[model samples]
Target: MNKRLYLELENCIGCRSCLAACTQCGGHDERNRNYVYDVNPLVNTQTMPLMCLHCVNPACARSCPAQAIQIHETGAVLSALVEKCIGCQNCTIACPYGIPKFDTEQNLMYKCDLCIDRSKDGIPPMCASVCPTNTLQWLTDEEIERKQKQFNVKNDKWVTSIHLENETNVRVNLPGILQGITKLY
Candidate 1:
């Protein structure tokens, strides 16, 4: 699909609307898979959302001894299959971004699946749907390209760390400070 999820880090207002909406997604069991973090509590109140980037070659899936973590056709790395998951937690240790969450009681691993029920049908994920600041967005490739060009974002893929940079399905535009621009969409 041409339509995909996009993130504009500078636009997050720390409203936590995305978190609330995440719990409402089907099969989430009232738990939010994504996270919001204070960029710098002492320096500023800037907060950013973090979620599974859905790596092109997901370590989470690779580490699954039971092969429970499956990637959907849309490249969304889905949660561990209940029947197949062995509760080994290997996926958690293997992931670089620390996106997967373990349920101690249920002995299961769960993470953002890009709201497959909705996203697979070309609808926006719950978080993107409720974001008032448009921090999280569902946009077409053309729209993303236009925004990236407008913001002077040379790279559409998210940079996980200095040592390891994996290409991901979800595109991102870094904060203004990192981009050397005062405005970001």
Candidate 2:
């Protein structure tokens, strides 16, 4: 199945539109919700949008005593059953990426659903729709693989190897380099 938010960090601008969209999506006030955080690298200025990785084997889902989180059929999106959650925060602690945010006001944990509701209407997520630059594009696994293959052929390099190196290197040189590089969660 197609699952994964393939990010081109080099193309990302420091705009907080994605973050704003995510917060609004999660039913949080503009002031309180920050699903994505902006990071300024020592060398450059770029906003890295942070959100749940929605891993194939999600630590949050495994750790949830209430079994509130479930992966969609596509496997890219994850949703939480707020009613089932007891605000234990086990998912939050289990997540290594720290993408899940705890809303003390609501006494529930919220995270990025990858805008599945919007996707059902065949529209891009709010973040992708509002991105000033065409950096963040949502695509299925097959589409991403095709692009990666094309990129490799054009560059005369191995895309998978580049990705592997990128994944291990926590100290990225460019801004937003770490957007989807880590599988921490």
In the range 1-185, model 1's lDDT, one tens digit per residue, is: 65778888888999999999999999898999999999899998889999988888899999999999999998889999999988999999999989999998989999999999999999999999999999899999899878867766446333333234367788777746565767644
Cα misplacement distance, residue 99 of candidate 1 (Å): 0.5
lDDT of 2 by residue, 80-176 (tens): 6868878889988887777677778877777776676665454666666777765556666666657655444432232222342223111112222
Local distance difference test, candidate 1: 0.86
Tell me the spans in candidate 2 whose CA falls farther than 4 Å from its real position.
1-4, 23-34, 41-43, 76-79, 153-185
lDDT of 2: 0.57
Worst 10 residues of 2 by lDDT: 166-175
lDDT against the true structure, each candidate: 0.86, 0.57
